[model samples]
Target: MILGYFFILGNTNCTAQSLPFLPDELTQVLESGLPKTLPSPAETGRFKKLPAGDGFVWLAESTATLKKGNKLAFSKTFDAPLKEDDVGFVAVRCRIVDADNNANEPRPGRVLIHIGDRETLRQTALYHKGTIGREWGWYFHPFRAARSLAANTGRIRLSFDVQPQRVEIEDVRLYVAPSGFDMSRLPMMEAGYQGREPDAPWRQGADARIAKYRTAPLIVRVLDPHGSTIQQADVRIRMRRHAFGFGSTFQVRLVDDISPDAIRYRQTFEELFHALVPVPALIPQHTPHAKDGNYANQLLSDLTNTLHWAHDRRLPMRG
Candidate 1:
């Protein structure tokens, strides 16, 4: 299977995406001063204390087990009165770990989210990669309106119908979109080589092309803070080539792991692929590495080809 991905470099007033999982780590890579529209688990104050008044804080990655027919449930009521802004959309994150000797693979489990007396929605907490021994992944559930529920005292509940097995529940929290909030206004990310679901088709196409060809020419026109284009500008470009392997199945995963180990690999690529790298003296013609070029002439050629291609396709190629 052929995999693809791309990065975006544009001038626009855009914020970063709200990645609840270690957002601080992501923020380091992302731009600053960007708004995080998603509400935090602390904002809800649902897991503040225990009912027994023992001052036990309900932590994430809590463990639980269930028989084949048994169902496990957990719920939280909103402390502050719900406002008009909390009515449109709702999202939450959940994870489940399977521990059992009888099964070699993971199975699908049932997840029910109770919005209120009127809405009791049902969804599946699918295993990671559809396998059974150990599974972990992000689970985002979207709902229509929390306003109706908020109108009636403002409370939310979550339920899990566990399959016959040992399951460990991870951190879970709910969020409601602001009033008159439009999802389209949300900041967008360039769908990388291995994009998650709910991707923008236009971006996906552009990203796919960049991934396959492994190169694209972009004319960087600098602009003042007031949006005026500057004639003289010094621009820099960063390019990186990635290699991913898949053996078990023909399904190609882009392997966009951003862990600490992968950081060094990414950094090496960034350094090697720096567009401003001076030409090496080894080659008489100043030829760059054909595999991943850094020579000025090679870059100019790529830019020329890109401009010609864009012109042929009637795509705007602004200088």
Candidate 2:
């Protein structure tokens, strides 16, 4: 039937809304379909009750166990925006059923319907017996309705514990409230703050010093081909443990961004990457005459080879 008008945000660049995605509007239309012009227990047509047999009403009893011969399957269809957060929200709002103790407040049961890369139940449905209905049903967690949702729409699920015998459910509303988040308040990002300053330089291959004089040690931890911490954080020294790991020789450029406050004070790459430490913590200290262990000899050789390669290949080593 005709539901509420909800708009989906897609590449279409349009704002045309429709129904089924909105529950309140659909409920109104469904409730008003009969002679009384309002929804009553009898007025709910194909609004089908959950579970297979035992009449739709009894399906509210989540604890009601059944034999293999008798089972129930409760399914519903909806049009919701496809996204990361919405999936979790829908599962909570539309399909959680808890247990209830009418004497005081009611407890709910969990009914999760997982359909994706992994077909598994997400959570349990809780049902609390309230005066409103025989069973308290919460199919999914409530989610804020976006003013403009994504265009990729699909049906969400509210499945009964398939393994359990009795699947009970009461009243559930498939709808969302208006979202109150204000995206306009988000801070606008600035350019040149992402390593685009003119003072930036290239220092790649073999731990080369990038900056000098800082609040603390200016560490440069090298990352190997694999995703692991190859070097510890330090400065002005070659990492000892990191000797085992060597990455492609490339330029490690550094730049300074103009602080919004003033010119004398600028935010440099050193400040940005200050948290990064040179991997391998302590280096194997060696005498100048000891093989390649000589820091000066290795530095000189690496720099010479790099400069020669850059000159021969006409690469941008100096910036």
Candidate 3:
């Protein structure tokens, strides 16, 4: 999300203001598909209505007891078929609880979306063990519409596959945006630990520490052989690398490939980053013939080439 800043400067005074903008182009879809109230009295299926204060706190929500290999489907129909370039956004506030109430253990699950009879889009679990606690949390998923499903039909289906567990769904929301819309600009849950709020007491000290330790004043001076400063000399300072490690896993093959795309990828990586960690090609576990010397030698060659390439461009390798 882009945070807007406005600055007012004067000879002796300056002020700055931060304004956050929320886009208005997004349209909500699939509202009818969501369960408004707990399923009706006569409702009978895998999903059952659960009232508030029943081991959880929600005005009303739906709970589904899913077994291994079982699937629960929720379908919605749009007034018009989605365009091929449209983007879909999903926000689900849900939590999965094991039958034995073991919140510490990781639970495996999958969420899938099907448009008409076209291909299915798979997503990983809604919440991991680290994020899952006694309360429900929101999870966001953004997807693109495939060309085959575009203008085919107005029906969209959501499927949930869970291990033997009880899944509590507090809310589900869907939105659609134009193809070029920036998904990162969409609103999402803020992730942080305790004492991260704007008014938190710890923030003042944290900001002070950052200002004192993370930044410094830079002074450049030009001197002559006579031990006198050259007052008229021009000085330029350019940062060649970062003081901190800011890097990502890069594909080793792409560094030396002749393909146009690979060359562009390497150029972009070098332009934007100062360090890298080579992926599978240099990783020992991914080496197939670890016991044999041939594969080991090849990996060593790739590593040597990568190190030379990085060194030529002043890029540091983490591992």
Who wins the TM-score comparison? 3
Per-residue lDDT tens digits for candidate 2, residues 1-319, read: 2112221111111111111133332111011111211112211111234443542333333333334321233333334433322212232222223333342333223344422211222221221111111233222233322112343233333434322223333333333333333222222111112122343333231124323321246546677679577766454665333322222223211112233432222133222221221111112222124224333364445445545544453343321
In candidate 3, the residue pairs with backbone N, CA or C atoms under 3 Å apart (3 or more residues apart, or in different chains) clash, namely none
Better of 1 and 3 by lDDT: 3
Model 3, residue 96: displacement in angstroms? 3.0
Worst 10 residues of 2 by lDDT: 28-37
| Regions more than 4 Å wrong, model 1 | 1-71, 80-94, 99-104, 108-110, 117-137, 184-319
Q: What is the lDDT of residue 8 in candidate 3?
A: 16
lDDT of 1 by residue, 1-319 (tens): 1111122222111112233232111112112221122122321121222222332222222134444422344444443333422322223332333323365433333344555532332221111111111233333433334223434344444444333333333334445555444433222223222223355346878888877796556778789999999887877776433242111210001123355544564344333432221212222332334223323454446445544533453334222
Ten contiguous residues with the weakest lDDT in model 1: 245-254
Cα lDDT tens digits for candidate 3, 15-63: 1111123467777666632545343321213556566563432222213
**C-alpha local distance difference test of each model:** 0.34, 0.29, 0.52
What C-alpha RMSD separates each model from the true structure? Answer: 22.3, 23.4, 13.7
Better of 2 and 3 by lDDT: 3
Scored by lDDT, model 3 comes in at 0.52
Taking all chains together, the TM-score of candidate 2 against the true structure is 0.24
Pick the winner on TM-score between candidates 1 and 3.
3
Cα distance off (Å), candidate 3, residue 21:
8.5
